[model samples]
Target: MRRAAIVGTGAIAAAHAESLRALGDRVELVAVADVDGERAAAFAKEWGVPRAHPGLAELLRAERLDLVHVCTPPRHHVPIALDCLAADVHVLVEKPPALSLSEVDLLVEAERASAGRVATVFQHRFGPAAIRLRRMAAEGVLGRSLVAKCDTLWYRGDAYFEVPWRGTWDSEGGGPTMGHGIHQFDLLLSILGPWSEIRALAARQARAVQTEDVSMALVTFADGTVASVVNSLLSPRETSELRFDFERATVEVEHLYGYTDAHWAITPAPGHDDVAASWREKPSGVVSGHRWQLAAVLDALDSGEPPPVTLADTRITMEFIAALYASAFTGTVVKAGDIGPDDPFYKSMEGAGAPWADAR
Candidate 1:
């Protein structure tokens, strides 16, 4: 069994710890680390972890871990991942893997030289229904994807941003686009493929924060499919939704956080009534979460291959976020590969600051 550890004792860390326990047959939860010593100790005790350290350095020196989950906040993802890379330990980092496209590129460069691989936690892509959707798309059962809509409308009040790191560009990245909506849209991108261009707008609608509480964009895929996107932190009756219109069927899913196959529905187009039966044939009851993804990660490692949500695919999602910010701030249509080394958005999602920075 591979030895593993977690580097943060936050709310999200519990999910990672539980996921590790669920995959106990293949890995051992050896240790845990957090800046808060007492909290780390408490977490270790609660989770039955053997060791607890005050920081990553201590945990690294104390245990010969094979895999490390970087469950810390966004700002610390890169540095900790870099440390893991230096130690040749594979990493399964949380979402918003790094704060910027440049930071992701840095990981890309470090990953090239390290013995271990870096995979982002995008568990939604591993759900049984999602796998079925990808297979159906590949088999042309859904036909050519024509248009889509992705919306992550969730509510967060001022108290939510009181955590100090919740809203800032440097700390949490670019608001809901980088945080809340990324999971839904990343799954969308996984199913639809590479996005070619985007034009977007952002605003600080309700939440009193440095970043936009609401963002909307029109994205065009390389395959000529078009999608309307929205990420918001100011909705009352909130939901996470995606709708894809293909030549043969319209596939849609609606859920709040995690989803099972039941949340998905497919409406067959004329002369394609068989699509409904095909959808029903897929497996069900698997909810999207860390457990599903952790299993895949271990399987990949066992096979001597890189894990799911590889850094290359991660770059696509990160670049898309950067492009959205670049377009929102500069009011320009940003094409794929436009945020190169020289671009401001490549260095940071703020990209010269949002238009309403001073006003907020």
Candidate 2:
């Protein structure tokens, strides 16, 4: 059994612990760590973990872990992940793996120098609905993907940002665009492949934070498909939705956080009723969450292959985020390869400084 430990005793870390427990004999949750000593010890006791440490250094020195889940906030992801990789321990980090693409590049270099692999937690891609959609697209059953829409409109009050890191450029990165909508948009990118260019706008309309509360973008894929992307934390009636308009049918998934088969639907385009029927006939029952992704990570480690949501795949998503921020802040169309080493957005999402910085 692979020995696993989770750093960060937050709610997400508990989810990782539960997922590790669910894996039974395949993996073991050996330790828990947090910046707060009491919190880490409490979490260890609560999860039945044998060890608890105040920090990653203590945990690493105590146990020879096979895997480490970097469940900390975005700013700390790269440092902790690098340390784990240097110790030859595979790492699974939560979403928004790093604050910037440059930081991701550093982690990539670290991984190259180590025997371990790094993966980000994008559990939405593991759902059966997502799997079925991917298969349909691959099999040409969905026909030519033309237009798409991804909306991640969820409500977050001003109190949510009182934590000091909830909506900052340096800590949590961008607001809804980086934290909330990334899941939906990442799945969208997974379906549509490489994005070509983006023209976008971001605003701090409601919440009191250092970042934009809402962002909208028009994205063009390399294959000539276009998409409208919306990420918001100001919506009263929250929902996460994605729609892909193919020549044969329109496939959609509607869910708030996670989704099952019942949350998905397909509408046939006139004579393409077979497409709808085939979608229903396909196997589905999995709910997208940490558990599903953890199982896949364990399987990949067992087979000596990179885990799901590898850093290379996540870099595409991160690059798209960089492009979105660049387009929004600069009032210019940003392309896939446009945000290279010299771009400010590559170093920070604020892109030198947000246009509205003085106004705020």
Candidate 3:
């Protein structure tokens, strides 16, 4: 069995523990660590873990762990993941894996230096519906992909930002674009492939935070497909939705947080009844969450291969976020290659402060 540990004791960490438990004999929850000693011990006891430590360094020294889930906030992801990789422990980090492209590059370097690999948690891609959609698209069942819409409009009150790191670029990255909508967009990228450019606008419409409460972008994929993407924490009626319009049909998934096969639907275009039937015939069973992704990660480790949501795969999503910020700040279209070494956005999502800084 693969011995695993969780690095945070927050709600998300508990979810990770639950999923690890659901994996049965494939993985063992050996330890849990939190900065708060009491919280760590309590979490360990609550989750039936064998050990608890106040910090990862102590846990690393004590346990022979095969994997460590970095469930800490966005700022700590890179450092924690790097530490785990250096100790030859595979790492599965939460969303918005690193604050910037450069930080992600550092983790990539560490992964190259170590025997173990690093994977970002993009569980949305693991759902059976997502898998089937990708397969159908590859097999030409979707025909020529055209326009698409991706929305992650969820509500977050000002109280949510009372946590010191919640809204700052130094910690949470960049509001809804990085924290909320990323899951849906990552799934979109997984299906549609690399994005070429983005034109975007960001605003602090409803919340008083360092980052924008909402952002919208027009993304152009390398294959000539265009998508309208929106990330918002101001919406009253929350929903996570992705719709792809193809030559043969319109395929969509509507849900909040994780999704199963039932959340997905396909509407065939005129004379495309066969495509709709085929979509229904595709495999079903898996639901996207920590459990499914963890299974894949453990299997990859067992087979001595890089896991799903690999650094390369993660870079695509990170680049898109960078481009979105860059476009919003500069009021110009940003391309995939635009935010490289010399780009200000490469190091910070604020890009020399947001364009609306003066207004705010």
Better of 1 and 2 by lDDT: 1
Deviation from truth (RMSD, Å), model 3: 1.1
Q: What lDDT score is found at residue 311 in candidate 3?
A: 98
Q: Which stretches of candidate 3 lie over 4 Å from their true place?
A: 282-285, 358-360
Question: What TM-score would candidate 2 get against the native?
Answer: 0.98
TM-score: model 1 vs. ground truth:
0.99
Instruction: Give lDDT for model 2.
Output: 0.92
Per-candidate count of clashing residue pairs (backbone under 3 Å):
0, 0, 0
Clashing pairs in 3: none
Tens-digit lDDT track of model 1 for 88-125: 99999999999999999999999999998999999999
The digit string of per-residue lDDT tens for model 2 on 137-189 reads 98999899999999998999888888877888989888888899999999999
Lowest-sum lDDT 10-residue window in model 1: 275-284
TM-scores of the models, in the given order? 0.99, 0.98, 0.98
Best by lDDT: 1
